[model samples]
Target: MSRMDHRNNRRKTWISRVSQYVDSSAGRISLTIALISIIGLYLYGREIRNKIAGVPTPSVVFRDKKRRRVLIIGGGYAGLLLAKALHHKLRDAPVHIEVLEARDKFYHNVASCRAVTEPGFGKQLWIPYDRFPVFVRRNCQVTDVHTNYVVTATNEEIPFDYLVLATGSINSIPSKFPITTASSQAVATLGRIQRSVAEAQHILIIGGGAAGCEIAGDIVDRYPSKRITIVEALATLLPGRAVTDEMRKVVTEKLARRAVEIVTGARVLLEDEEFELSGAGFPEPRRRVLFTDSGMALDSDLQIVCSGNLHYNGHCLQKLAHTHPTILDEHTHEVCVRKTLQLYDPMLPHIFAIGDVANCITSKTIVACEIQAKVAVQNLLVLLNAEFESGVGRDDLPARLKALVQVEPLQEFGVPGPLLFITLGRSDGAAQLPFLGVLGGWFMRRLKSQDGMTASWWRQLGYDNVLSNT
Candidate 1:
C-alpha cells in the first residue's frame, strides 16, 4: 500500500513540474524577441543617423604613397592626443606633422585644482613642449592659423596643409600655465594664487561644478581649520546631473563631516575682498554684511572663481570653431558632425574638435575629455581610410535620454564616473559612481586617480622614458 502511494505521489510531482515549464515558454520567447528588437533598432537607428549626418569623403588614400601633412594647433590633451593618433596611424608613412603649442609644456588642467590641496604636484603638472615632435613653440603663442601656415605672436610663419585646433581652455592661474607665453609673468601668477590661499582663513568657492566642488574639497581638506564655504549656483550641489544619489550624499556628508558648509541654489554677485552671494541658500541676513536680491555675503576670506571657461578670448589664438560648422551649430546650438565626428564644413574633411574645446558639452570633466580624444582619434582614422563609423557621445544624462540623444559614449577613466574621486589632505575620500549607485572610501581616489595618474601621453610625446634617462 505504501509503495503504490509513493509511486502515485512521484508521478503527480513530475506532472506539476512539466506544467510550470510549459506555462513559462511564451514569456521567455517574448523576452528574447524584445531584446533582439531593441538591439536591432539601435543599430539601424545609428546607421540611419550616419547616412543623414553625411560624413566627408577622404582625400588622402589610406595606403597612398605620398606623405600626409597634418598640422595640430595647441598641445594640451587635444593636440598631444591627435599627434599620438597620427603617429600610430601613419607609422609606416612619411607623415609631415607640426604641432604648435605655446609655453614649453602641456599643463595638466584637471590636476590644477588638485594642486590647491597637494602643493607637490603643481610643478610636475607642466611638461615641456619638447615632449612632442614636430615644431615646438617654447615661449610662444599662436596669432593665426591661415589656410597655408600658422602665424605666431612672434611673427613666425610655420607652413602646414591639414590643421587640428586642440588648443584647450584657458585658466587664470599664473604659474599654472597661461594660454600664451613662458615668462616671469606666469611665475608671478602662480606665486599670487599660493599666497592668496595661504593668507585666507575663510574661503568662499563659487559655482559647485566639477571645478568648484573639487576645489572646495581640496581647500577644506588642506586647510581643515579654515572656515570653508561652497556656494553652488544651481539648486543642488551636482544638480540635474546623473551622479549617484549615494555619491552626492557621500560628498555632502563628507563636506559636512569636515565642517565645510555648502550653500546651494544661489547666484554669485561680487568677488570683493569679502565673498558675497545673492539670495544665497541662506534665508537670514547677517549684521555687517551686504544683502542683495540673492542673499547676504558668504564672508569669504579668499574667493576663487570657477565661473566656467572663457570662450570669446579663445579665438584670439587660432580661428578653430570659426570655420568648422561641426564644432557648433548656427541655429539649434548643436554639434554639426556625424557620429563619425567630421565637421559639417567640407573644408575640415578628416579633422575633429575635442576636450575642453569641444562645443555643446554637458559634462566638462577630464573624463569626458579623454573619451572625446579616443573617439576623435578612432573616427579620424576611419575618415582617413574612406569609411564611415558611429559613436555615442552624450554627457551627463540617463540612458533613455542618452538614447534619445543617442550618441556613442566616450571612454571615462575615473572610477564610477560620477562622484569625483579626489584626495583631501592625505588621500582620504569618498567617490560616487552615480551610474552604479556605488560608494567607497579612498579606493577610487588613491588607486584610480592619484596613483593611477600616469601621464600616458609622455610615451606618446616620446618624453617620459627618454627624458628621465637623460
Candidate 2:
C-alpha cells in the first residue's frame, strides 16, 4: 500500500476504536467528566494568575466630550458599591465613574482579625480593585479637594462634575491595613502577625470592644492553651456599640468559656513610645509589662491594641474648610454632610460624603457604609438626571443649581435600622439585629464567622470565579 493510503487506514482504525468506546454510556460519562475538569482547571488557573499578577485596568472611553465625571475618593466598601451602582445606573448615560484609592487592593477589614490568626488566609482579604465594575485609580492619594477638582499627592489635578468622598478611616494594624498597602505587603503583614500570635505564650489585647474580643477569640481558637487577656476602660465589653446587654453577655460568656481573661473599668496607661514599641512586634526576652489606670500591672509576651484609635480620612477636605467652615465636624473631624449626604454647603451641593468619613449617626460598619452608598447614588442620580432634563450645560453653575432636584436623605429612603454582628471566631459569634434582638453563636457563625463573609463580598463585587474557591 502507498504511504498516504496506509496513514489514512491507520487513522480510520483509530477513529473506529474511539467510536466503539464512545458508544458505551460509561465512556461518554467519563469523556464529559474529563472535559469538565479540564475547563474547571483552566478557569481556576486564570483566576490565580489574575490574583497574583493583578488584572489590568480597562481602557477609559470618553465617547462624548460632554460626559459627566463622578469621582469617588475611597475604594472601601462604600466607594466600591457606589461606583458599581453608578456604573450600572448610568451604563447608557453620558457619564463616567472613577474611584481614587490610596491602596492598591481593597482590604477587607472585616476579615482582618481572622487573617491575623490564620496564615495563608490573608490572600483572600486583599482583593484587587480591577475586579470592580468601575475604573479604579489605585495608589492615588488626594491631597486637597476644591469646588470643582481634587489635587493628588503627586500634584496631579483631577476635575469631576460630581464628587463623593468615602475615604473611610484608619485603624491599628491587623484591624485595618495601612494606606498604599499592596496585596503582597498586606499578605506579608498578616503572615508576620500570625507568626507573632503563634509564638507568644501570653497575649495582651487592650480594649474589650468588638475588635479586641474577636482578636482574642481568633487567637484562642488557634492556640487554645495560650494565655490571653483583654483590658478595657469601659465597665463592660463592647462599650460604645449599639449592642444590647444580652449581646454583650453572649460575647463575654463566649470569651470566658474560651478561658480568655477580661479586665474592665481599667485603661492601659502606656506612653506613646511604649505603646508603639509594644505593638511593633516581639522583641528580645519577649516579655512586656503594661499598667492600667487602676494600678494594675499586666505582663504578656505580645500586645495587641484595639482601643478604637480610629482617625477619619477626611484631611483632604481641609482646604475647603477655609471657605465652608462646616465642611468638617469640629469635634469628630469627619466630613459634615446634610441628610442628602451632600457636603452641607449650598455652594458645593455637587460634593457628597459617605462611609466613616461622613458625620452620619450610624455605626462605622460595612452595612452602614453600603446603605449610605445606595442613598448617595440615588441622590446623585437625581441631580444628574435633572441636569440632563433641564438642557443646561455641565459648566453652567447657575443653571445646574436651578436644575437640581430635591433629593431625599437616608431617613426618607427607609434605611435599615442599626445591626451589629460580632464574631468571636470561625464557629462562634454574637449579633444585635433590629427585631431579632440579640442572637447567639449559631446565628453569628452562619451569618459572619464561618468565612468572615468574604465569599459574599467577592461575589458582590463581581468576582464569581474567586467565589468558587472561597
Candidate 3:
C-alpha cells in the first residue's frame, strides 16, 4: 500500500477512461456512417424513381433557350426546397425558377420559440434569400393568383409557365414575423420580446403545442426564477400525430421538475381585442389575469400566445373558388391536392401546392414539406418534358396536363408517418421517429437543438457560411 500500489490504480483508471472515450467515439462514428448511408440511398432511390417516372436528369439539357418560367409563391421550407431542387436537378435545363416571398429572408420557424427567448440566437435563424443562387423577389406580395398569372400588390402582372404555392401557414406575431419584415427587423422584434419576457415576473403561455412547450422550456432554463404556465385547448399536450404519450410524459415531467404549471382543456376567450381576464380574482396592473372557457382563470405578468397560424387560403382560393370550390378542405381549411400533389381541379395541372397549405393528412412539419417538394419537383420535370416533346407552350400544356389525361398522374405527398421532435431546452428534448417510437433527451438535443441546425440549413440552401451572410 505505497507508491507502487497508487501507480497501479492510476494506470487502471487511465485505461478505463480511454476505453470509455473509444466506445463513445465508435458509437458516434457508427451513427454518422448510418446517417450518411441512409441519405445516400434516399438520394439514389429518388434519382432512380425520377427516371422511372419520366423525369429528366440534370444531364438532360434542353436546347431551346426559351426558358420556362417557374414562379413560386412563398419562400418557406417547401418553396425553398422546390427552388433548390429545380436549380440542382434541372441544371442548364430550360427552366427559370423564381420565388416571390413577402419577407426579405427565410425564417427558421422551428427554432423560433427558443430564438424569441434568446435573442442572441435569433439572427442565426433567418437566412437572406440573396445568399442563395435562386432568384428571389423579396417584399413582393401576391394579391391574386390565376391559372397562369399572378397579380402583385403593386398591380404588376407576372406570368409563369408553372406556379407553386408554398406560402405556408400564417400564425400569430411571435410564431410568425410580419409578412413584409426584413431579417434585421425580425431579429429586433425577437429582442424586444425577449426584453419584455425578462422583465416580467410571471409568464403565461397559451397553447401546449410544440411552440408553447418550447417557449416554456427555454424561458424556464434561462430564467429559473420566473413562474411559467402553459395552457392548451386539448385534453392532453401535443395531441394527435404530433407526439406520443411517452414523449409527452417525459416533457411533462421535465416541465414539472422546473415547477412550470400546465393546464389542459382551456380555451382563451377574446373580449374587445383583449383576453377576458376581469372575472379572475387577481386585479389588473399588478397581475394580468386570463379567462378561459373551462372556467379556469390564470394570472401572470406577461402572456405569450403560442397558438396556430391564421388561415392563408385567401391568396389563391379567391381564384379557385369559382373554378374549383371542392378543392378546399372544409375542416383543415387547406387546399386539397390530388394523388400527384397538384390542385384537385384537373384544369390547373401546372399549378402545385406544398407545405402547410396542402392537406396531406400529416401533421404540418418540415419533413413533410421536404418530401412534398421532392414529389412536386419530380412531377413538374415530367410535365416539362411532355411540353417540350409536344412543342406545346405553357398555356397549351394545361389542357394536355398528363395528370388530367390519366397517363401519368403526379405522386402524392404520401401520408407522413409519425416524425416529431420537441425540445425541452437546449440540452434536452424528446422525439418520435418512424420505426423508433420515442427517443431520449441526449439523442434529440444532438439531432436538432444543439446549434438549432441553422448552419446545416444554410448549407442545405446552397450557402457555405451562415454567419458570413449575417
Which residues of candidate 1, in runs, are more than 4 Å off? 1-65, 118-120, 133-135, 146-149, 155-157, 171-177, 181-188, 240-242, 271-293, 312-338, 360-362, 387-422, 432-435, 448-470
| Model 3: colliding residue pairs | 170-309, 170-310, 171-309, 340-410
TM-score against truth, every candidate:
0.67, 0.81, 0.85
lDDT by residue (tens digit), candidate 1, 1-470: 69999999999999997667545866445544554464344324444565689943233343324454667666776667667756665666555766766766666566556556554445545555664555655555777655456788888887653456666654434212445444344333444565567667777766665566667767676777888777777766656354556666766777788998888877877534333221111111122232324866656556666655534223532365565434554443333444444444545454445555545233555555545555565554544343212222222123212232333342222211353454344455554443344435435443434522435544655666423522
Q: Which prediction has more favorable lDDT, 1 or 3?
A: 3
Residue 260 CA error for candidate 2 (Å)?
Answer: 1.1
lDDT of 2: 0.78
Ranked candidates (lDDT, high to low): 2, 3, 1
lDDT of 2 by residue, 1-470 (tens): 99999999999999999988876777766654664464344324443564689853222233234888899999889898888877876787778789999988778888888986887888888776656778899999999998788999999999998999999876777777668666687687778778888889999998888889888888898789999999999999988656678878888998999899999999998674645631423233258887988789999988887877467888898888988998987665699887888888867778999988988776777777767776777678767755665667778766666556343232322334547788887888877766556756655665689889888888766787543433
Candidate 3 local lDDT, 1-470, one digit each (tens): 99999999999999998668646967656664665465445434666665789964624333354778899998888899889988887777667889998887788878877775775778878887766778899989987877678999899999987888888876655677657667787787677777788788889888888888888988888888889988888887886665678878878888989999888887876453443322211112235676899677787788777776556544556765567786776554688788788888877777888998987777888887888888898788777766666554444555546533453655555676667778877887777765556766667667786766677888876688876667
| Counted clashes in each candidate structure | 16, 0, 4
Instruction: Identify the runs in model 3 with alpha carbons over 4 angstroms from their true place.
Output: 1-25, 28-65, 272-286, 329-333, 394-406
User: In order, what lDDT does every prediction score?
Assistant: 0.53, 0.78, 0.75
